[model samples]
Structure formats: C-alpha cells, structure tokens
Target: MISKFCKEVRQEIFFTWIMWGVVILGIVGVSAASGFEHTVTGAYARGSVRWLLGMDLYSEGMHGFLYLPHAAIFYSPFAVMPAWLGEPLWRVLMIGSFAYGIYALAGELEKRYVANLFTVSSLVALPMVLDSARNGQMTLLLTGLMLLATRDLLRKEYGFMTVWLVLGFALKPLIVVMFMLIGGVYARTMLRLAIGLVVMFVLPMLMASPSYVLAQYVGFIGKSSVATDPYELLYSRFCDVFGMLRAWGMPVNGELQTLVRIFVALAVWGVCYCGRRMWGHHLGACLILTFSICYLMLFNPRTEINTYSMLSVVLGIYVGWAIILNKQTIIGGCLIAFAVMIAFSYEVVHQLTPGREYWLPPLLTCVFTGYVLFLMVFDIRPVVKVDRVSPTQSDMLGVDAEKEAEGLVMTSSVS
Candidate 1:
C-alpha cells in the first residue's frame, strides 16, 4: 500500500512541479512590473507604519486602511521590510499558503487520487491565485485558512481548527459568517474560539498603548459600519447583492436590505445544516466551506470583484470533484464553465456591459448556490469514493441503477 501510494503521488507530482514553477514565475513577473505603491500589499504594510507613528488606523475613504488595528500587527513584518522586498514576499506567502491548502485538503479524503484532484483544482484556481498574488491581497490567506479549517473539522481536530479560525477572524472579521456555521456544529470549539478572539483582539495592545489600541478599535467599528452603506461615496463599487440590484436600476431600501440579509443568512445556515446531515463529514465539510465562501462573496456588503479570489481554493476543488473525479458526470460538468468564468471574473467584467459588469460573478454564484441546494436536498450523492477506486480513470462513467433509484426515492420524499 505504501509503495502504491508513492507511485500514485510520483506519477502526478512529477509533472505537477513544472506547472507550479510556472505559477511562481507568474507571481515574480507580476511583482516585478507592479510598483510597491500601487499594490494592495502597499496598503496592508502601510497600516503598520501608521499605527507605529500613532496615527488613526481607519481614515475617511475606501482607500483608507479598513481592517482592525490588530491586522497592522499582523502585517508588521512586511511593513518593516522595504517595498521591493515586501511586495514579492507577501504575494508569495499568500499564494504559497493557498497551494499548501490545496495539498493538505486533497490528501485528506482521497489518498489514491490526491494528485489527480490537486492538479485539476490547482489549474483551475491559478487565475484567481495569480490575481490575488499580484495585488498582494489577503483574500488568498483567508481562503487558505478556510480550507485548512475545513480539513481540521473533518479530522475532529478542534485545537488546530481554533488556531486557524481565530487567526482568520483576526485578519478579516467578516469571516464570522463561517464562524457562525462552524459554531452551530461545534459549540465548545466556538467557545474556545470566542476566548481566542478576545485574546487576539487585545494582543495588539502589548505592542501599542492601551488608549491608542482602544481608539483604533473604535475606529474599526466605525469603518465596519460603512461596509453596508450603499450611499457612501466610494471609488470602487461593491460586488454584493446591492451591486447587482443597483446595477439593474432597483436601489434597495436599507430596512429591506437588512431583512434580506437576515433571511438569506438563515437560509444559508439551513442549507449548510442539511448538507452535513445528508452528506456526512467527508463531503459535508467541504460543501459547508464551499457554500459559505460563495455566500460571503454574494451577500457581504463590501465584497469587491477581486475579493472573489476567495473562492479559488474551494471552487477549484469542487469543479475537479464535479467534472474530473466525480462519478456524477451529469450535473458535475455544470460547474466547469462557472469555474472558468469565476476565476477570470476580474477580466470577464471588462468584457461585459458597463452598467452591470460587477453583477456577473455574484449572479452566477446565486445559480451555483441553488444548484448545490438541489443536489443536497435530493440526496444526489456524487458516489465517487476515491479510497476504493483505481488510480487510472476511464473515459467516462455513468450513474449506476441502484444509486439512481435511491436518488429518485429521496427526491420524492423531500417533495
């Protein structure tokens, strides 16, 4: 078994390294051409500089630093470094973390087809990976943490899950959406995470004065309020539901928007709960994070087009599961085009009509979310357990009669 595992890994990894080498080059190329002042890394590192000088962490506009003061402490290492040095390093760090996330996740469930799954997903994830890496965006880091957190949850390793989830929460508080779902499943861990969050929230005070840190925290609260303000004057447009609606010439009322958010949040939690019950841990955990991230992009008030890069890790793996490794070739292929469309969403937006280009990815994501709910509610299992399957795949596989009948009965029962 060890020898066979080695062979399977060897066959796929032999060629995989070459592809990764290309990815590294792409990151280097983007870094070389990008000015330190222009990249998001510049903004990230600047917060630390501002904090060190005892300036306000949050400023007036979208261009102002928007994260918690703790985020500056997180970026301090990069801030101390020169821009040329920091830019490439930060980019590589995020993209590398994302790649490691893929490696870890693919290894967890399907040892035999690990490379096959890794290759397809990585290839699909590359565009967004490259996009985020170029800009030195932290979306990849958060995405990596999400994948690792999902893997830890599957292993019942709540200790490591707490570390990842807490660090992720400190970096971007919006991931509380994920925390809420995971909290629903693992209540005790959520308590540990809550305490962990308190520790992290105050960790910045050790480096700065308490008054200053407290003021920064207050500023963070004010900054967060603007995230849902559709009327706020900003250079960049939000790519959330508000963006989609406003693009269609239907501005939403604030009260209605809040109600909509609550309703959707409940529905998403229900979908995730049903997924866990219907699919069990192996597949359930992956879908939970996958759908949660999708929800984040569509509903989170300040979601930007490039922020959609957060979907790369999960969506890529899901597409590979659907089109390449999945036994259910029928509905699986449905995501293939979407994978491409989403990965290159930053580019696709330019090709679209000017008025509503930002709506494209979120709109497609809504459809994807509905498709997943359909699959789960119908108990339409993908039925491809990589553990027992041969390493070599045939041209195509069909739905076996027994599984098909089971799916029909489950669908009728739900109806």
Candidate 2:
C-alpha cells in the first residue's frame, strides 16, 4: 500500500511540475511582449498606495476623492515599493501563493493534479495574468486564503482555519458569508472567526479613526453606483447580468434591481446548503459551483472584464473534475461551452461582438446567469445514483457507466 501510494504521488508530482513550467513560460513570454498593456485601475492602485499612506512621493489627481480612504490603506505597502521592484515581485508572490494554496486545497481532499491544472489553466489566458500583475488586486490572495480555510476546516483544524477565514473576510468583507456557512457547520470554529472578524476589521477602523471606516465603506458603495463597463473601461470583457441590461438600454436603477438581487442571493444560499450535505466526488463540485454561481450572481453584475479573469480558477476546477470523472457528456460539453462563452464574453468582449454594440455584455451576462440557473435546477447533479453492487459487478458495468462515474468523481472533487 505504501509503495502504491508513493507511485501515485510521484506521477502526480511529475504532472504538476510540467504544468507549472508551461504556465511560467507563458507568463514570461507575455511579459516580454511590448504590446502588453497595464490596467488603469491597477496602475492607479499601485500609485495611490504612496499618496494615501504619505509614504514615498506626494500624490496628485481626483482618483483619491472617489474611494473609501480605508480601501487604499490596504495597498500602501505595495505602493511604497518602487514599481521596478514592486511589479515583478508582487506578481510572483501572488501567483506563487495562489499556486501553493491550490495545491494545499487539492491535497486536503486528496484530489489529483490540482496544482498542475490550476497553474496550467490560469496561464492559458492573458487577461488572468494581467489581473494579478497590473492592479495588485487581492483576487489571488483572497482565493488562496479561501482555499486554505476550506482545507483546514475540512480537516477540523479549527483554530488555524478561523485565522484564514478572518484574513479572507478582511481582504473582501463579502467572503464573510462563506465563512459564516462554514462556521454554521462547525459551530466552535465559527465563534473564533466571529471574534476574530470583530477584532480585525474593528482594529483597522479604530486605528484609522472611527468615522473613517464607515466613511470609506459608504464612499466605496457610492462610487460603485456610477458603474463603468469593466471591459470597455478597462479594455477587457464584461460578462454579468448588468452587462446585458446596460447594453440593452435597460434601466440600472438599484432600487428596481432588488428582485434580481433577492433571487440571486437565495440561489447562492441554496448552493451553499447543498455543498454542506455532499462529500467525496460530490464535494468539490458542490463547493466550486457554489462559489462560482454565488460570485457571478451576487457580486458580478457590476464586475469588469479584467475581474472575470479570476473566474478561470473556478472554471478550471470544474474542467479538471470533468476530465478525471469522464463526466462531460455531449450535453455536459454543450453546457460547459455555454458557461465558457459567458465567462469569455466578459473577459474578451472584443471577440463576441463589436464595441458598437453596447448590449452584448449584458446579454451574455444574463445568458450566463440563466445558464447557471439551468445547471443548478437540472444539469449539475447525478444522472443516476449507484446502489450496492458487488465489486466485480461494479467493475463490469462497461465503458459507459464507468466513464459516467469517473466524470462525477472529477466534478465532485473540486468547486
């Protein structure tokens, strides 16, 4: 048994190393090209770190007036470093942390080739690398923390798990919902997380000035209302429900958007609930679907194309699972294609339609939304449950049944 396990580990490690090499090579190739553009917001985030923190140089411009001052505080450390030093180092660190986190998460559940797939898939697109490098956004970091927290929680590493959850919540407060769900399942850990959040978020606010916290938060929300197409504005794709609506000349009045919000929120909660009940092959699918759907439905209507680059991680999880489980039936392939289209529409908006068309993004986003709903309602489940069967009988079910189960296992392993 020990020898067999070691053999499997060696094979998996070989695949992982190959995948990592390919991705790193791709990233280096892209960076070498002169045509590569940095995102304006990313540039701003990097520059603003100095201005907000009064660290290096005096800042200029109206950009600071729009956001919660507190938000900028997070980036001060990165900003203090010169761009020459900061850019490559920051990007490498984020990519490395994300890869490590992915490896750790996959290992916790004993999934094969997670690190390799994550590294390879993330490298397939230009937008994904740009999102991490340009803005120094917390996407990779947040994802890493979430993955780590999930793994730790599963292992009942309550204290350490809570620490990661708190850090995740600090990075993006919305992830608190996910932490809450995990906490609910593990009551003792949840208490530690809740206390930790109060201390973390509160300490920052208290350190800044009591009014600054509410002011920055309120300021961020207010600024967010003046929505820009992340694709058009940032030169990336915009794929979310709002993208379609805005393109179609539909009113984006937040007050009127309540129904959509409520519907999406409920759907997300439902996915989380289902994730809680599943295990083994079903577990990863449940978690990935829950995270992706919730991310798209609840957080992404106002998202920009560059932001959609982050979704590839979730998509990779699904795809990886599909390969191992042999699950993407002809029908499943079509559905996967549709989901990819929706995701890509936002990430690479230029290919789907001409910029003259405003409605394309929103339309694609809505279609993606509907696609998720369809999968949730009808598509993302077992075709048939396996009953008790002799080992010999189960093994002899022929290619069709064996392939189907394999696909299910792949899908179930990550999400």
Candidate 3:
C-alpha cells in the first residue's frame, strides 16, 4: 500500500501544483493580513521621500534609513506609489522572485525530484517566508538574488553572477562578503565585480547630488556602527552568535565580538578553500554555497529572525538532496520532519509560553547550522566511486567463448 501510494504521488501533476498553490496563497494571505507600519521596506520608502525633500536621512530618536544611498534611489519608484497599491505590488514581486528562485534551483534535479521541491521548500520556509511577507522585509528578495547568483556561479556565468551579487549587496551591503568566496574560486570574476561596485556607487550620484550621496554613505556607516554596538538598545534585535552570547550573560564586548566573528569567518573560509576541488561536482558545489550562506547568517552581527529567511533555501536544498540522492529513506524522512518542526518552533513555543520563544528558536537555528557545517565538511562524498578489478582464472576461461562452445559440442557428441 505504501508503494502504491508512492507510485500515485510520483505520477500526479495536480498534487505538485496544489503544493505550489499553497505556498503562493500562504505568502499572499500572510502579507495581506499583517501590519506593515514599521517595516524595512517602509523605512526605505520613507527615506526616499525624505531624501527628495532634502531632509536628513538620519535624525535623533528616529528609526531612520539604515541602507546605502543606492538603496534609496532603488526605492524611489515604490515610494511614489500609494501604499495601498505599492505594498501589494511589493509583496507579489517578492513572492514571485522567491518562487522563481526555487524553481530555478529545482531545475538542477531530475523530474522525480522536482515534483516535491515546492512542497518541501514551502514547509521548510514557512516561518521565514511568512515573517518576511508579513513584515515587508527584504529578506526574501535578498535570498532569491543569492540563489540566482549561486545558479549563475554554478553555470560559470561570472558576469551575470556578479550582477545578482551586486543587486543583493545594494539591498544589504553585508552580502559583500560573498565576493570573497567567489573570488577565491574564480579570481577573474573580481574584475567584473569591481566594475559592478563602481557602477552601483556612481548611479546614486545621478539621482542625488554627489555630495549628498557621499554624505548619506558616511551617515549610513556612522549609524550602522552605533546600531551594531552590543550595549545599544537596537542591538537586542540581533540574533547571531554575539547576540546569543550576550543573552547568555556573557560579557560580549564589541571589540571581542568583532575578533571572534572574524576568526570564525576565517575558519569557515579556510575550510571552503581547502575543499575548492570539490566544487567540480554538483552536490559538493551546492553544499559549499549553502555552507557559505549559513556561515554568513551565523557570523553577521546584525542578523535577526527575518535574516534567517536565507536558511530556508539551504534547508530546502539539503532536504531535496537527501530525498533524491540518499539511500536511507527513513533518515531522509526524519530530517525533513525535523526541519518542519524547527520551522514552526517559534509558533509552537509562543502558543505554549508567550515571550519565552526568543532564545530557543535562535539557539535551535545555531545548533542546526553547526550540524549543516559538519555535514558539508565530512558527510558528503563523491557521487561516483573508482573501481579496480583483476580477472580470475575462471573469468579468463570465459574470454575464449568460441573455444568453450567447441568443447561443449564435442562433449555432447561423446555423451
């Protein structure tokens, strides 16, 4: 009966579409039902309007824009549209981008594997996707761009990859760390990336005065520095290693935190560099990309729950690979089940004990990330094995088929 059910699911296209439909409806439903009065995107929209009016981007007691001037220039179009229209349009675009990115990655797998991609991704990404949609956050869009960039990188399309990376960096400058991973593998891509950066920096000058753009950049750096201070009120939002340490009663001094983050990042990068040869295989390459993203999320000092949207992509990839490639079905099923539970950990904990969900969710994510890193380094093996065989005397006797046939005929005649 289980085999019959598996066969039916494999053959059904309607089920696949239904799964995708659920994901789309879920994103739209969550976005429309939630408040967006204080979102990252809204902040950008407000900042764009302020910039046009010659107002200071940063002011006292205001949750002013924290992004680069280029971000304001990008948000100007949405800023002009009324919120009623703009908000829905932005939500739809983010959802579409994320869906397309998942589809593109799924294209790498075989048809049998592709059918379950959306279902698994939706389950694993439920919390983060819903949170991003509800809060009008850029995390989904950033994740999509990063996935697109990874696809391009795997195809050896360095120029296009750089474009994707540049767009992601424009939205969140910390993504620039990805360039180091790319550069180590494809050194020549750095030239294209440099050009992209120059264009990104110069394009804002065309929209706003050079001096104004320069001032905004300076203001962003200064404000960002203050925001990253562990003692600052805003730092409570951080959910990375430093934040967890601080939450656990550790004396997380800013300087020490910076050093620790740098050391961890360097260690992860060294592992990647050492395993650079593994990129020749598809699974190895995916693992490397996923590891780099996981490292970024864990190491970045400013990460929050919204920032974890990127991990959904990693989870989706890992679950998909396990289902399609691993021989242990029970293990794969358990992993998928565990991932779903983790995805909804916050909601479950919140319902049982409100306000106590803070540490557990983030801590669980950190533990899961460590497990993923370990798998990337040690669990993955080459897809194909090299075989060495030497023929025995019996095998050698079989080599002369004509002689053996003659002998068999002579013996039959004697009998």
Candidate 4:
C-alpha cells in the first residue's frame, strides 16, 4: 500500500544519510568554488590568526569577532590551513555535524513517536539550513550541538549535556538562554555547567600565554556586550519580534523589550519546573527546546535570517510528529503552513518594502511560540498514546501502570 515516496522516506537510516550527504556536498562545493571572502568565515579565521599572534581577538578597530577566545581555539586548526582547504573543511564540519545531528534526533523521535520524520523535517527546513551552510554561520554548528544535547538531557545524562552546552558557548554568548532554561529544570545541571564553562575558559591558556588568554576573555565580555546591543548594530532592520512590531507600527522601547524578554525567560523557567510533570520527558524536551529557539528569534536583538535554521529544525520535527500522531490536526496544519512561509521568506523578503525584510521570520516564530505555549499550558497527555510510555517514564511521571496500560490519559493538571 505504501507509495514510492513513502517507501523511500521510510528506509530507516541509510536513505537519510544519502539525502544529507548530497546536501553537504552541494553546499560545500559551492563555498569551495566561490572564495569565502564574503562569508563569515573571515571573522573566525581572523580570530584564530590573532590568537596565534598573541594579539587581541576582540579588537575594537577590527570588528565582526564577537565570539569568545575559546572560539579561536576551536577554529585554529582550520585557520592554520590554506584557504582552499580550510574553508571547505570548516563548511564540512558545519554541515556534516548539522546533518548528523538531525539524523540522530530523528532516530530517537522515530523510536518514540513512530513517524517518518528525518527527511520530511530536513527538506522542510532545507532553505534556511542551506542559507546557513552557504554563509558558514556558527548557527549550524550550534544547532547541531544543541540537538545532540537535547537528546542527552532527555536521557538524564547531565554530564554529556553539559559538554555540548559549553561547546556552544564558544560560538555565541546568546547560547546562555538555552543554558539557563535547561539549568532551571535540572538543578544539578548548574553544577555541571559551572564546571564545563570553567574548563572552556581555562582550556585556551594552553595555546597562548595565560595573561594573553585572560585578557582575550575579558575582551570577549566587553565585545559580546556591545555585539548584543541593538545600537551597536550597523543596520536598522532586524529579523526579530521588535522588527516585525516596528514594521507594523507598534514600536517598543529597547528597555521595555528587555523587560519583555526577562518576563518570557521567567515563564520558560516555570515551564521547565512544571511541564515535565504534566507531560512525559518526550514532550517536555520538545517544549524546552522549542521555547529556547523561539525566544532566541523573538527576543534577541541581533537575530538574522540564518538563525531561523535553528528554529526551523525544531519546528519541522514537531510538525511532522503532530501530523503523524493525528491528534492535533489543526495545530499541525498551522505549523506546516508556517514552515512553508519560512522556506520562502528569503525569496519574499526582497519584494516587500524596505525595513520590512525583518517581518516574516520573527512573526512566524511568534506564532510558533504561541502554539508551544498552548501545548505547555494545556494538558498534552492526550496527544501521546498512553501505551507508549515506558515503565520508567510512567514511574517518573507518577502514572498508574494499570491505568496507563488501559489507555487512560494521565489527568494531571498544570499548576
């Protein structure tokens, strides 16, 4: 009864690998053909060279390097190579890890949710993913690491999760939002996080003088602070919630926006504390990651179109799961529509009026966040079949084994 498309998509693992392998080769081939002068690889390469020279990594005169000193260490191997080899290698790392992360996460979801998700979500999110890959953006790498880390967190492997989280810190300071949200749910995570960050901060001293490394760390703080400030950004248009609001004539003050972000952070913390008990770990991880990525797009001052790749991956997977489960058809349809919008946002942005380039991505992210919040606030046990909860999950969720075996939904109310 299965069609050719369904059979191909359902071919477990090798088929997905073949698909992403083609994607990686295609995108990396383009970057290799075109010199990477216009891509963000320059910033990463420059920082690596500066570290080798014992120079300041975050020099004010030479901008575009907002990452921590650890980032230089991470990229130094590629930086030291010839441009021809190094650029393609870096893209390989970005796109390869991204594809692998999706495969790993999709495998886990298929085991749990019983859906054909890998290719569907990847193809749905490909437009944004391709944009990030072509530009050599760290969002690809960070999203990859976070996707792996999300699996570890759901498995209760805090130590492994902390390792991935700290690696993300070396790329962008905004990763702190995810760290904070995860730390809120797993209180013991803060201890592991503190230890991991210490290791990241101290690891660079081995390459350069301790004093030089320490100074770069200090410079990283000042540089990242400025990098996050909207006033420091060169352009007026942003691809965030505020940008959409400004385009819609509902401008909010910067200070007020900070307060709004803070409020959302607190609300996410509450979700972490309470949402786990209401739903199983499967949906809890979904909500945590969804809220984290949505916040980054809707709240961060410097969000770009490429950053939507991170959001797209998470949303795409959830959309596929919703439709496959056949429990929330309406929300699933909305998510599919938005996924189409995001995939076409780049083509559509240029046709709109100036300064409105920031409109669709964040507006779509805001709508996505609303659906995530709805799932968190309302009881979601009905969405998952009762028999799917493993014994350990039932114990952790405090569900009656006999009742769950009888297909009775857990009636736990959200506090």
- List clash counts for every candidate, in order: 0, 22, 0, 0
**245-275: candidate 3 lDDT, tens digit per residue:** 5556664676777787678777766666555
Candidate 3 regions exceeding 4 Å error are 1-30, 33-40, 60-62, 109-119, 233-237, 279-284, 349-356, 376-379, 382-415
Candidate 2 lDDT for residue 91: 59
* Candidate 2 per-residue lDDT over residues 290-399, each given as its tens digit: 46434553345445554554454555554444543444556335435534554455335555556623344345435545554565556464223333333343434322
Error of 2 at 385 (Å): 11
Please give the RMSD to the true structure for each candidate, in Å: 5.3, 6.8, 10.6, 4.4
Which residue pairs collide, candidate 1? none
Q: State which candidate has the highest lDDT.
A: 4
Q: Give the 10-residue window scoring lowest on summed lDDT in candidate 3.
A: 406-415
Candidates ranked, most accurate by TM-score first: 4, 1, 3, 2
**Per-residue lDDT for 250 in model 4?**
77
C-alpha TM-score for every candidate: 0.87, 0.68, 0.80, 0.88
Candidate 4's TM-score reads 0.88
Per-residue CA lDDT of candidate 1, range 132-178, in tens? 67777888888888878877887889889888888888887877888
Ordered by lDDT, highest first, the candidates read 4, 1, 3, 2
RMSD of 2: 6.8
* lDDT of each candidate versus the true structure: 0.70, 0.51, 0.63, 0.75
